[model samples]
Target chain A: MKRRTFLITTTAALAAASIPVARYYSNGKKNYPPLIMPEELGNFCEEKVIREIGDQYRKQVPQESEKAKLQQILLTDDAGKLTAVSDNAAIAALLDKKIQDDFNSSRILVLSGWVISVTEARQCALFSLT
Target chain B: MHIDARQLDNQSVIEGDICIIGAGAAGISMALDLENSAHKVILLEGGGMEYDDRVQELYNGKLTGHPYYPMKASRLHYFGGSTGHWGGMCSTFDEIDFEKRDWVENSGWPITLKDISPFYPKAHEILDLGAFEWGAEYWVKQNNALKLLPLDDNIIWSKMWHFSPPTRFGTKYKDAVVNAKNIHLYTYANVVDIVATDNVASIKQVTIKNYAGKEHTVKAKKFVLACCSIQTSRLLLASNKQAPHGLGNDNDLVGRYFMEHAELKTGEMWLNHTEPLSFYLMGDKTKVRAELAISPQKQKELGILNATVSLMPLAMSKNTIPSIKIWSQDDPRKALDTFHKYSNLDKRNYIQKLFSKGFYQSYGLYTRSEQLPNPDSRVVLSEEKDELGVPRANLHWALSPIDKKTVYTINKVLGQQIGAARLGRVKLYDFLLNDDPQLPDYTSGGWHHMGTTRMHEDPKKGVVDANCRIHGIDNLYVAGSSCYTTGGAVNPTLTLVAISLRLSDHLKKTM
Candidate 1:
């Protein structure tokens, strides 16, 4: 279905389901907009999830220097910093830790609320920074 | 005397000074208050003292919005009504729930918080709860270790809630109602129709039927519909023999304005310091649990709805990433089982690998927010009929944009509040923060059905007036959450019981 038809169908479904579709359909006339947009908000959520994953990964690795090195590499030029187009493979190549080989660029990920390819996540640092 | 309507003659006529339909929390509470009074009371319970599959089929209906619990499994049809399976989390509605807030559509009640404040203490007794205290100071004083998160009180504060021993009215007050000299308790009395006068201004009698081949007519000086929200509206809408539009439905408002306590897991909170947060935890001996609550002033300032958040440790929270998919299962119980199994496996793995590293326990922020009352969200009669021939209640449980906005704003506000306090960070769930927001699979309700027969002074705006009397009707009243004009973000039992007691007082004066 087209985007407009999709919204109309979804709104009709919501009306039937007892959800408040009017809030969105009203186009901010009565409903207030959030202080932050979806992607911005999702970035924070993604960062949190990735940080937790990193923390768990750190526990298994048992190397404090490796953890610090990985964090530092994510911010440096070698890690494809500020590149408009970057992928997981490019960033992983710069990591000093041998576990860098574990990087899987083609993997699909659901970060925060955004569904994206692993390569797309490299652009946002798993929603930490863009 | 306890009489079985099924044992009565086919056309038996029963008379009383006051007749209360549905012996649930509200009906039983009202009857208990009127015991040994000058006037005689008749209490009608559709089912027997226990659950009956045949009677429960009356609640079977279709769901049209977010997936809800099966209608049949959602509420019990026996004598105690829903209190039979209630979790007994009790708290009073905030003062704001009664006020006509500019932000909330169709908000405000004809009565103020103070109007029902006097009866809350009595209701506490009826519900077998602790004191009437819902303040932070009262609970904090009881347990010194209970320190609220050091957040700005003006923005957010601790809202205390007391748990009930979960008094099942069927088991708790059955004997008292059964033996009351002036109170007549009738079982198996399914009211098929409410017979109103030609003017449709007063209910002359109610006709009830039973599978035992007995039919009866109950007449009273006054009548109260204390059935649960959906059933109350169903009876009013189905009783169209006298009024073409059904009794108390001249405004087409009887079944409108349905509301629920929209419970959602909004985000995760990671405390930087391990304070144990013992006060917020459900203790074996403690009577209350505190949730981070947005103050009414903040709500008005921000144009948000009343909402509260409880913290659940990640180990126990059912919303973990690996298991949240289980919630999509059609059967809520099966979904819960799948979640538990997946969560348990995840928990065991994390404990094995991360326990040695002192991994900080993360907590999930469970949000229970108020739904802005919407006329479009309502209860309507379905084409399906039950064994007793009553049309099943087809529920259109819609959420308003304001309702979704409430969740998003509160989570966002909480994130900001936590960051500002330097306490910890809050990461809102992805779905809530997404542009095309979809309700997460885990979203459900507190099973608090309300606002079907909203109380208002104007007949056009409500099904019942300030006195709980159906507008333009001389003696018909509603005595449950169905009479609520606006539902706050708390369980409805305490406030609803208080409302029922207030109605009892009104009847005592008028009868």
Candidate 2:
């Protein structure tokens, strides 16, 4: 199946469950919920793993400002987000790129003693909120 | 023939064509190489066939710079020397290890790996290793189960290592050495002082003493010090009657440039999926294994020293203690016991269950790396002397910024590689995350001492020449790791024996 078709099917399947969303303004003009949702990450990892990674992320990057900066980097279309995503597949592809970019650019964190990209940490943080 | 030096009468003079001081791996290899040759070879060992408390005490010394293993327990003083306890991991040095790396200060050897390549087969035989093959592809081709990690070949490569049935030279080669017509093995014949001519141009004879109070002189046309790196330098620095500084100390480089393989657990690798990394596993049945090594180009590009990374199942590795901590007992026997106790902890059934269940796909990344030769990291003659009246060695194992940086960079690059491959993520230890150059308290060495009497063509830069002969001294040579210009990432035994055989060949030609 095509990636757009897969994302639309996933969104339809996950529509029964409520996902808490946070709003952020891009270019100080438009407001949208996070492109990648915490519920969306369930397709990749377990809830326990996400929570454990979230705890580690908070410990290593303790400052709220630093966490906010990383979250912004993940959510914003300006810096590391390489594409305009209309669905979960595009967001997943973008997340993969950001993770690779984080590694290539040395923007990595020791999450639960496993070196992981910032985008993965942000998704875990988003999962911890629910 | 084997003779106990203590049985000799006081002031006895023994003569030989070549006198090799120390019956460790190097001395024995050299003696075995000269077996049945036309020239007489005297192989002198300070300790006897068994471990002696009083004799082992001679290795006791002070550590002033870094936290290290108890000097007394770090090296064995008996017949086989430290090889009695050696784990018997062996590999040949890379071409880069002998090159004059511009980024590493005081790097490079007078002779390249090619110069010593011919002798490695003989070294492999001496160590009882497999067919002298050290490439990953060769071993991989032999075993279908040996699966290598798919990493960028240009950035990282697999370096192969073979395990020795760990041939204990004392037991395995004792008969060969004692039976050889031209090789005379002397036990408890500790060399005390080397007498030189008035000008200190050449070695005339050496004095050997034993606890039995028997003092004797051994005169030979040539002498080789194979008493390990520290003791070799100690003997040179202590022989100060003719040359007030020491024998071959005109340039004062006799006891300098000490180095060790900086070994430590640097990181953890969490695989994305469960994969049997059979190629890297080391077990009783394992004949050969591969360790991940940074390519020469990668090391040069990053300005880091040569290093290799080994993987261990995290389940057992997390419970393991650093060797420097376990090997701290003053008695080598006690230290060995402690080391064995801790090493056996991983063999429990619960650890085996963890592996069988495939619950955790994580591995501990361990580094065995080269240390840049720092002159300050050296051995000096201590004012305090041992029971033999010869001064004990004082080790100051100082490490430079490059040492810690090389380790940190290795883990970091490996992390990058894992991410690129999507294999897994690599989490560096907290100690490596900082920008500080100092090594962590857990940092340890492989107990493979080297580079005290480094080899170089120029007398100003090294104590020995390219041929392992002490510069400016016609007949004195160092036939061990003391002549090593740099200690590569692999264990030093294979290279030390290969070079010793090379030195033996040189002696055969000149004598």
Residue-wise lDDT of candidate 2 within B418-471, one digit each (tens)?
877777767778788676787876689888899989998889999999999999
Lowest lDDT block of 10, candidate 2 chain A: A18-27
lDDT of candidate 1 vs native? 0.72
- Model 2 has an lDDT value of 0.81
DockQ of candidate 1 against the true complex: 0.04
Q: How does chain A of every candidate compare to the true chain A by TM-score? A: 0.27, 0.50
Q: Could you say which candidate leads in lDDT? A: 2
For candidate 1, the per-residue lDDT at B396 reads: 85
- Candidate 2 TM-score, C-alpha based: 0.87
Give lDDT: candidate 2, residue B373.
95
Best-matching candidate per TM-score: 2
List per-model TM-scores for chain B: 0.93, 0.98
Q: In candidate 1 chain B, what residue range of length 10 has the lowest lDDT sum?
A: B351-360
Position B89, candidate 1: lDDT: 79
**Model 1 alpha-carbon drift over 4 Å, by segment:** A1-130, B318-361, B437-441
| Candidate 2: regions farther than 4 A off | A1-86, A97-130, B339-350
